[model samples]
Target: MSRHLIYLSILTSLTACAGNSRPAVQQDTTSAITGTDTLNRMVLVPGGTFSMGADDSTGMPDEYPKHSVKVDSFWMDEHEVTNREFAAFVAATGYVTTAEKPISKEELMATLPPGSAEPDSSMLAAGALVFTPPNHAVPFNDVSQWWSFIAGASWQHPEGPGSDIKGRENHPVTQVSWHDAQTYAKWAGKRLPTEAEWEYAARGGLSNQIYPWGSEALTAGKPKANTWNGNFPYKNTHTDGFENTAPVKSYNPNGYQLYDMSGNVWEWVSDLYDARYYAQVENGAANPSGPAKGYDPEDPALEKHVIRGGSYMCSDEYCRGYRVSARMKTTPESGLANLGFRCVRSVTHH
Candidate 1:
């Protein structure tokens, strides 16, 4: 059956049962673990030697001087943590995400232009950047053209106030910062994977492959992952079964039984943000913890942290960070619709 038809059927069933029962919790629980336990939680990625950075001529300048690095075995989340999973953490711990707090008036005024209307409480409240469809094509380099600061858009209320998880409990929770991810990891007795560990898991035991599924194009006869298919920022044909992020396990897993390691949402890592950190790491068996301090030339006010994997919004025209080597940095406090995370645990045979 066509994907549209399937979605329609699912939507129809959901609507029919919306009034009679708590379908969200039921569907979420079932969808959350539809795949193998290895795919649903962390899988031990046995470490080995592999080239770390990008060597391709088509690669970006920052991903230069590809070099080999050896990583020790580590257990990494096979899939990005889902909304339902994160909600459980919040329910158990009463944790407050960074984005859920109110933004100080001084901090809010700094970003807004002088003579702008007095900021409303809602406007000054900390929220995530939600992508709004632009009326016309805009330069991909300028994210402000498409991304808007939506008030009250946290992990629970993803698109802002009045929006709830509802049927999206199985989807990866967005608007989570690095600190928020770490808190959840600690609560779950896990940790954020290091840059080396994340890359190792993303490679899925494939040596130097461009993507998780080897060098094959994203789609040959069928769509591979959730990514832009049509004119980006204008019309998304959603040929890949979704325009935005699909549910967890919606796509095929890599060789290591990991899902959504490429697209869907960019995941947080434990490393501090440093563009040239990889170049300085010792060639041998050192567990490198990025730079001593986090830094980013783009926005230096707040400390930045490393984020891996490109998001569903990533496109060749804009951010082509879908590859295993692709990396980006964001403030530890910054969260957005495309930002989420997974957890990792150290492997030890009992």
Candidate 2:
């Protein structure tokens, strides 16, 4: 199977989108930026110039053409947006998430290959993608071995009907699409971090370092972040004291007091994903917002957005997605079990 299709198969829910509620967040900034989480919950990222993308050959092709870029100071959430937090947003707005809505026949047909037979209506029901680890080792080429689209797998029931966020409210919310994240950001009077802003904040004042905390290998010392520690898909050592998502502050914060910048769940960013975008940025450009439009040659039909911070599923063998300069992309509408996001606000002028 092709690379994009492999991830698309594993990352996407069988088909659908759907609901949310809301609450309040902001508690500072002279009451101007109301409806956002408190400034106490955020850290001010002092902006400066730094090299974006991989400094060496360790990163994937998309992270290539390491170039210098500058960004402005901004307020960033200290940790991934928690389930309790997202719950508040949903409670107040009564908004629906992508996973809870049904998929249109045309939308489902668009993903199928030409001349393919249409799927039955039952197969187009509302759902979300989930990570289902197999009992035995399987080839990585076919991600379907470990992922499946489960009906009713919304953020509230991430793993399906029997699952709930009861004890995991402090954990980052999953099964959230880029659109969902954007909606929450807007309601909170914030926005998703741009790719450049994300990378800059993730670096935490250190340039060219590997992980958010530093160059120390994850397995070299004390547990760093929540990630797969054994054979992926089949076995996990639980070395990080977590089988899946960890509570937001479970790990140490980076230099900027940012938590889970490297692991836990992938974070949605404002930038569109273009495999060749880094090459387009001049080495010394200031505040590049990412490609005007995303173009993934492998999956030209789908529009993809940048997602940062690896997840509990990342490993040394399959992915070092936690690396400071690492990058990945997925469609705006798809939600998964290990993908969530945070918000960043431009400095309030008040």
**How much lDDT does each candidate structure score?**
0.71, 0.80
Q: Which candidate is the best by TM-score?
A: 2
lDDT of 1 by residue, 50-152 (tens): 7877737777655666777777777667789989888787887789988788766666666555875655666556667677768778765555556667767
- Strongest candidate by lDDT: 2
lDDT of 2: 0.80
Backbone collision count in every prediction? 0, 28
Using all chains and alpha carbons, the TM-scores for the candidates as numbered come to 0.83, 0.90
Query: What is the Cα-based lDDT of residue 331 in candidate 2?
Result: 79
Tens-place lDDT digits, model 2, residues 243-309: 9999988988877878899989989999998889988877888878988889776566667888888
Candidate 1 vs. true structure, TM-score: 0.83
